[model samples]
Target: MNAPRTPLLEMRGIDKAFGGVPALRQSRLCVGRGEVHALIGQNGAGKSTLIKILTGAYARDAGTIVFDGKGVDFKVPIAAQRAGLSTIYQELNLVPQRSVAENIFLGREPTRFGLIDWRHVEVESARILAGFGMSVDVSRPLRSCNTATQQMTAIARAVSMRAKLVIMDEPTSSLDETEVSTLFGVIRKLKADGVSVVFVSHRLDELYAVCDRITVMRDGQTVAEREMAGFPKLDLVAAMLGKELSVLQGTRRAGPDASMPEVLGVQHLRSGTRVKDASVTVRRGEIVGLGGLLGSGRTELARAVFGADAVDAGQIRIKGKLVKLDEPADAIARGVAFLSEDRKTEGIIADLSIRENLCLVLSPRLARLGIVDNRKQHEITEEFIRKLGIRCAGPDQPIRELSGGNQQKVLLARWLAAGIDLLLLDEPTRGIDVGAKAEILELIRGLADSQGLSVLIIASELEELVAASDRVAVLRDGHTVAELTGDDINESAVMAAMANGTANAAAPAQAGIQEVAHG
Candidate 1:
């Protein structure tokens, strides 16, 4: 047999720093031709730094990078793109108002005599999408399509650049099972065409399913590299977390319990295709999970309950009294707070200081005669910063200055400081580091136990839902198909529910017991 193909791109001894703080130290990655290489790490593991270095968003302090047999240094993102490298970020960078064809061939659309060639753009986009087994209308605005379609469009755009190496950051985070499998097919196609892919995701299952090799990073250093064939999932987790598998698996030191009073109850809730006929009970002193595939209506259920969306038909009761929630303020006034999924869009006012962002929701309580109490705001902000371990330069620091994880913590603090009785968290720990995830989980648990607070958490990571939830309610096709509790709330059970809407009857009863805990 011929020798194995050489790596299409290689980076050795890459080092990087942010604001004088070392973020990545000597991390190494090699992406072979026609292979999927995964990068795994906890939050703050320097994953972002490494990607930035590769994409030319940030210059590496020290490294030897060779792409397609040529040693090179990229000083800007454009240079990397021109060199056949394309990155699809976790945040889904696309102009929603633009058509699919426009987004795919944005800057370099077909032109005739200095004027744009719209007809050619659509034909090219259609042909490209057809290769991926998609026939979506390329002329329609991107936002009109479901999130999965939008993601597919992004992938198509990347490949249209003739990218030899595609960096997919959390590509499947927002995709359903079917959509995810479809994406995998596309990845395989890319590989068959001799394209190298860098896959980064918090979901280990996806990594195991697609990656040929795994590179583990921790605290800004490449810790281990292992082939996928014999790699144990637990070992992968251990590597990313910097802990042994045995040490990581166990009951939480303290977790939520059953038999809690229902702080908020919804019977037969419906909101768009995202949420349909969903019923859930969040009890005081417990963290219940809304588990499902992407578009299973987990976030939609949260939004409906929090009044972010109109409940087409349902009964919502708080403290045993039926209530009307016409808007966010109505929910807030009823002691229910929702932390939205996208923090930058819905959670933070970037121009505001950390203190202001924390107090934005609670300002009414601190206000006297319509005059804001700056002194009280400062005190509360200081208290939360210390309590939540939010890293910031000071209270005066703009909220935008913090990292993604830190910005998320501030959003959590915003709701926690309000001392709401019921919290609807949509992917509360999303995009955060492992340590931050654990910390946030612990904080939510403690708040439930100590303050009799109730929480309904929606997270895409199934392991997180399994670990943090006292009970789990799974949705499928916008309906609550299964509920698990106690012994039934495991990865298998949640997966089954999401896949086929099947569950052991004992699961719901176990969850019923926990509901009494808070009552």
Candidate 2:
């Protein structure tokens, strides 16, 4: 007789709502021992809501949760943690100012004679980190180390707590290639030790490379579940997009018009530790791409151009006129808009309605007699909601309640409505699913083509940038090392530029070059 299979964690018919609005509807997932399972969906697709419910950050209205073969319901995060579940969010929730040992052993520290034992804490912390092949000084402040080291520390803390299931949300977003490999090695070690893991990320390549199984979510429900070997990356993308695989392959188009005039110019720019000697130009009716590995200065370059970061030395000209954008307001005044990389902390106003979020940037222009015009605001919000196909119940819906992709569209609409001359986008499609990503890319292309808009896009996915950009600017250690276009574009060339800042050959970027229709 075949051995009976048993799930270590199983959640069935999970239902959750916020203020009478349904966030998750009948969502279901299962995890087995020693397997790395990935949960994926677009923002607002209920991935976070579902995880929060599982971790006891939010109580589910209806559902069944069985962990380690017993029915369970947790009232708080601590309760869930105590039951052998641990979650590491995208944002490092660790205390940066505190020592590594302190952050690792937070809340529950070793006690001797009713007082915390500092020496035991450090000793245990060092031993835990060492298991992950790390030997850093545990006494140092967590902020002193880079993101990779911080990530390792977080993982060590989770494992130290005897967690049975470790849920890592976008754990590799800020990690470099080497760091990612190291993390994968640690994951393998955990798997060997019989600890299950739930990996969540927008990077599909990483998912296929590491996860043993995949679960796709859409509109707050689990749509498909398949073993890793049985699924293709493109197929998984189609499932997340809620579209047939054949349709996605059929719709392929290049970027903006080549004949448009230059709208924004950057020359020899430098900002702080990162962002060095970089130069880029964006033409009206074109989408220029900034491509590089993590920490290669993609976000830094965007920040410098948008004046979010102070540029030590550089020249910026808008429409052939010099402008000193020392602050974000100055950049906006110059008709420049920036969509930040991190959406939670940098983009949305959690408490505002969809209308307010959409009109936040264009308030002054939409105002009259020192009074806000509600009708005009409604019209603007409705137009964008229809135009971008944002799936919200109404314009009055809370901005925080909308899905990630819809929120991004609202941000894009904010800039588009402001009559801006230049748009700076940083990882604009970071956490969104396949379908939304395609729609956003198409929207960008159409805007640049039909509206004569100028856009600078920073994206980590090589294929995405190559597919949608007029030119790819490769950065290495805060400097612009290479810019590839017609006859100099491909994965090999981009990677070559990224690793060494120079390559022997470059392939022509024929696909992204704008078509010319001469009379």
Candidate 3:
């Protein structure tokens, strides 16, 4: 019998820090040849830090990296790439001004007689892209392509490198259902070709779908490592969050207060093809969830209510008064704040400091005679940072530098600072870790109970929807199919309603009720 084969990559006792603050301690990982391994943790839990150390983007203060059975310490990203390691970050590193072909073969274009070969670049780039089932013009600027195309282009570039190990950070964040399926196929092909992958994503379903082994990290330490098959989802979440299942449930309200009045009401709402007809009501001090499948108009309905998107035909009532919310400003003036799902593009002003981003909407109010009071701005930022337990250097720190969890807290704090009465949250805890999700959900429940903040939220995770929502309105095919309240607000009931597109006829009337939705 042959001797046991060694892992393709191994890191042991890795330690790293920033500004004297430890980000990783005793973090270790082992990846076998041709294995798809998962690295999961909460934001700021050392996932990114460990990956950076592996890719040579950051130097580890202490540890050993053994790749292909040899110890090595690469000084820079290029050096690591040359050593058969490639990383495709969540943030695209390609140049917007360059064409797809130029990006794919950047720094390594084929040569013909000591000169550049544009023809080879185009043909080879197309061949690589075709492997991902993408058929866009290779000559076009990468910026002109859709988000899915751009992501596929990035993956093509990584595959073309022909590295031994590839690290993908949230690679499916931009892709749709079909595109995600295509990506899975590509990943399978890569496995067949004997390339190992370090897959990182917050989405749990995707993890179970692709990864063979799981490594859970929490608070800069490796907590658990197990085969993905035997590991339960609850156990994985518990390890990543460092909490028990009971404690992880967080604070869920005992349904809405009976005395509380409806703060937000939409009747027969219509917005483009995505939202044909939708109706729901959220009472003060209540969290209402929009439950639906992909492309079921949950996001569109939320946007229309917040006035971020156009309302083709609908009636909106705020506090029992009909209002026309034509624009976001109109909604804001009426005490509505929306947390966008696309955090990078629509939620945060990445270039600004945390102080500026937090107080952006409230700045005008702080201004006296066109001069905003700087002291008041800092005061608000400090207050919310403290209130939300935001871990940061200071309010002046660039918001882009914070982890996903802290950034999300800042966005929620932004609305809290603006004195908004109603909150519309789209995928509030999408990319953050399980611990962050717990914190955010608990915070929302606290707001609804203490501040009487009415909330209408969209969540892709059925467990999250069932746990956080006081009442869940199920929608399918752009129509309000059923509503689940109190005892009926469970995963099975929500999934049934969404799939069947109708209320349960046998149960009590309160068990399932369809909203007043019309086409």
Candidate 4:
């Protein structure tokens, strides 16, 4: 037998902790040269922490990292890059106003006679992009190109660095189908050139399409590792969830009753290019989920309904009465609440105390004669903190000091304090630990069941949508394509509707449910 090939990169016995809580424990990963390795887990499953350790963004408490047959410690990201490893994060870090050529050669531009060579930069950038089957003008500003082109330019920058290993984190999260195909082609080219790749994505199909080996993480540990060819999708999901397939299959609950009063309705909703002619309904005490790919108008529809975005054309009915929401104040005045996807910027007021953040939306109602009631605010904050199980030092603790899950809870409490009838949540469980996710999901179910709250939720996670939604509205290219309910509200069926833009007729639907035709 031939001699065994050495691994391109190896990480073993990794341990990381934050605030006395372990994020990773004895996590291990080994990647071979010229192979596409997939790292998969739910939010806060240590994937990000591990990658940060590898890239020197976060120092590991305990671990041994071996790369290119040598032991090395990278003190910073630049050090990692200089050591022949590069990482492309979900958010592209390139300057938007700079030309593509300038972005590619940002810090390391070629010089001629003590000056930067613009022509050489453009020629080299074009050559690098052409290698990836991209022909965009390198002289144009980066922001002039679409999201896909900008992402490709980021990859080109990484490749041009002569990196032996490239780590891509959620690279396709914002790309369309065709754009994703283009990215896959580039990955194949990189593999052929003996470059190792570490791919991280929430999309299972993309992992199945491009990865050679797979590693699954759960609860801050390496749970499973296997070849991608024969691995079952259900098995992978189960591994990530730390549950058996049978347990997951049995967790599908029944949908809510259709006879309930229609609490919210949208007819022919159109907002900009992303949301076009979309329609949906939420019944009293029911949860409706919006399901689609990243650019498929789910967020746009939510924003339109919440009046965060201007509606070009649409009719919104609240409790059988037509209403026009010209601004967010109108929606809030009508007892509507929205929880944005980006919790850090849009949801929480980090500088304020937890009590202050919780009382923000209800400030007007809680005040008397232009004066604030500090005692009443404290009482209300304490009540919500106990009810929502928000872990914090006290009501006076800054919201920024709390964990992601606790911060989300405070935001939820803000709306609850306002006594809203309908809540719009976008990726409520995103970027939180699994235990926290379960708690939040349970709280949502309780709100619908006990408090008669109608909710419209937008979630990228298919399982969350299927489990929590009484009916799921599928959107494609900004149009509501189908509405799945009962037995039809499943992972396979939803994936079919998203991929093909058509509902599966064979799947059984609940009574009184109708398909939403695209306009």
Which candidate has the highest lDDT of all?
4
The superposed Cα distance between candidate 4 and the true structure at residue 301, in angstroms, equals 6.1
Question: Global CA lDDT of candidate 1, please?
Answer: 0.80
lDDT scores for all predictions?
0.80, 0.81, 0.82, 0.84
| Residue-by-residue lDDT tens digits, candidate 2, 1-519 | 111156788898999988998889999889988888889985567899989999988999998999999999988999999989999998989999999999999988989999899999999999988999989999999999989889998898888899999999988766766788888889989989888999997655566668888888988999888886656544554566464522221222455557767788888887875666788988887788897655567888888878889988889888888878788999988889999988878899989999999999888887889889999999999999998888999989999998888899999998889989899999889888998888888888888877888889987666677777878788765678798875466555665565445632233212111111000
User: Among all windows of ten consecutive residues in candidate 2, which has the lowest summed lDDT?
Assistant: 510-519
TM match of model 3 to true structure: 0.65
lDDT assessment of candidate 2: 0.81
Q: Is candidate 1 or candidate 4 better by lDDT?
A: 4
List residue ranges in candidate 3 displaced over 4 A: 1-5, 132-137, 246-256, 265-281, 287-317, 320-328, 337-420, 423-519
Give per-residue lDDT, candidate 3, residue 56: 86
lDDT tens digits by residue: candidate 3, 1-519: 111145899899999988998899988998889988888886678998998899888999998999988998989999899988988887889998999999989999999999999999999999988876778899999999877778878778878888899899978765656767777777877787899899987655577778888788888999988887666654564565454434323234696667889899999898875677899999998999997755578888988887878988989999889998888999999899999988878888999999999998998999999999999999999999998899999999999999888899999999999999999999999889999999999899889888989999898777788889999998875788798887777665665565345544223322222221122
Candidate 4 lDDT, 1-519, residue by residue in tens: 111156899898999999999999999888989989998886678999999999899999998999999998899999999989989999899999999999999999999999999999999999999999989899999999999999988888888899999999988766766787888889999999999999997656677778889888887999988888666655565576554433331144454677889889999988875787799999999999898765678888988888889999989998888988889999999989999999999988889999899999888887899888989999999999999999999999999999999999999999988999999999999989989988898899888888999999888777788888888899866788799877777776665565445566333222112121122
What TM-scores do the predictions have?
A: 0.64, 0.63, 0.65, 0.73
Model 2 TM-score on a 0 to 1 scale: 0.63
